[model samples]
Target: MDLNSVYQRLNTGSKKWSQYPEDVLPMWVADMDFPVAPPIMQALKNRLEHPLLGYSVAQDTLRQTLVEHLARRYGWHVQPQDLVFLPGVEPGVNMALNTLAPPGSGVVVQTPNYSPLLSAPANWKLPRVDLPLQADANGEYPTDIAALQHALLSARTFLLSNPHNPMGKVFDREELQAIGDACVRHDVLIVSDEIHADILFDGRRHTPVASLSAEIADRSVTLMSASKAWNIAGMKTAFAIIQNADLRERFNAGRLGLVDSVNALGLEATHAAYSQGEAWLQQVNAYLQDNRDYLAHAIKNRFPGVRMHLPQSTYLAWLDCSALDIQHPQAFFLREAKVALSDGLEFGEDCGQFVRLNFGCPRPMLEEALARMERSLQPPA
Candidate 1:
């Protein structure tokens, strides 16, 4: 629960740490810098008591735990059998696209989305219809319903990222309801990614898109995981809730060889995360919110050229560096500041003036990154 404590992840085979040089600070990836919750570690340790590390299936208890969790946390009731386990959310996405959406059909995705979600449509040879999120006067990003409807007209599927990445905009219930109604009207399948559902700021609650109504649930494929919230991405486990029996069967069937079964330890860790990690989650959410506030303050006070709105859900910040007069913000920071961040171009072609910074690390680390970035902006002597 010590949010300020820093751990050495440089040589720990961490994807986030290993991606950048030893001297560079990595604030790019979505993974957190904190260690796993004690309960999660204990669950893994308990599972290791058994010597077999072979492939495994999700136990009935695990499924029931998830079922209870969905209902309790989001007020979304789902049957135990409605859940389909997968190695990760991306595969589930590809599975839904490959099986449900027809080839050459249009897939509607919001702009400035996660790189993988933005590119998944192309992997299936489907045309991607871009719908950009516009910010209001209050610096809040709201979905344009008319634009969404227009995009959905030709699109067969809508890939939704609730508690959206990069922007960290959590769609309100009204917005979600409107979107679901629109999709239902257009006969568009909904692939809702709620991976960041459990990570929210300002006491905001997460609402599952399918949970809006039973009719919406029928047409929706909700992909969720404990990875983002519980800091367990390396476990490689996630689940999809397909309420429609036919769709669920089709989605499970499409996992052709490329998508495999979940590992034993991941299943245990997931159950522990839901069953026992609530206290840990509460602590971490508070810490992340504070970190977000500090980062926003730093951007406003220290960096004149950088602009960022407070994120409502996730720890990632979409910083607009257009005022800084930098051609490529990501590359500039990486080379000049020795700070590696996710390039805005990866999110969308029009996002070249932006860079996504992950602030889920310890406070000192976040402060250090900001200091390095601030120093990089200084004029040469």
Candidate 2:
């Protein structure tokens, strides 16, 4: 895995590259710039040799692999029958909302969440209740348990992003326990997105909220995938773990002919990822941590106008450009610096001054982006 080598994705129809002009550096999307793990690539190649591309289902081996993975990595034991395959986590979320939530009921979601999670409730005409997570002096975002309980009063389902996106906040055991207890108290179903579970930094362990107790497990739909960690988002495969058979059946029914079966290659790659991609993932995490530190240092020393907290997980960094006095930081960088970043407004209404940067690239590319951004902020001669 030569992560330092920059691959050319310019003419490859890549979403990250194609979204911006030729001159602009795109550090916006959640996907990484590195190549897929060797094992995943080999699995896909082997699967292609079969010469049949029809509708597919997950094999028993794949389920067992995932079951072993969860138990070994997170110490979260789940039966093989608990998994429900899906095309993506977003659809799983919408499915949970459509089937589990009463029509026109409120859905509780933390503010500044991934755009899809933030907007999924509206797709089913469910009201969205926002519970904001604020950063403390140490730059850690802690859940407001009291506020969460209050919000759950008006909501029937809770949309959670564990190892959260945009802000890159990872919830600890205590926080997750509080959240699960509150949901259990209020009878609110938990729809958690744990897609980035395997990408933690600094030896942090991931805890599935449902794994805390049987009571929580009965009422939770936890969605996960290897896409984010393995750089295989293009495969478009994810799964949900529903311990309650009744809830699993209802969630599968909510597909409504819109969400189809998982991709054939995705399933093969997923099995390979869980079984043999750990070494590759470990290296990627270390590289990302270094990139994160470099970016944080650059922001502090070069771009004084920009403020950012060190992300606990994932390769995305939430940058606060409030001090720069820029009305729209995303647009400003795109126009003046030729650097494309995810606009904060998409995550939350009050995040207009913020922009999310993806640090999952070669070190040279990260340095180049920082250089361009620093030059863009310089005072006129």
Candidate 2: segments with Cα more than 4 A from true spot: none
Candidate 2, run of 10 with poorest lDDT: 135-144
Over 150-261, each residue of candidate 2 has an lDDT whose tens digit, in order, gives: 9999999999999999888889999999999999999999999999998989888899999999999999999999999999999999999999999999999998999998
- Each model's lDDT: 0.94, 0.94
RMSD versus native structure for model 1: 0.7
Displacement of residue 97 (Cα, Å) in model 2 is: 0.4
Error of 2 at 10 (Å): 1.4
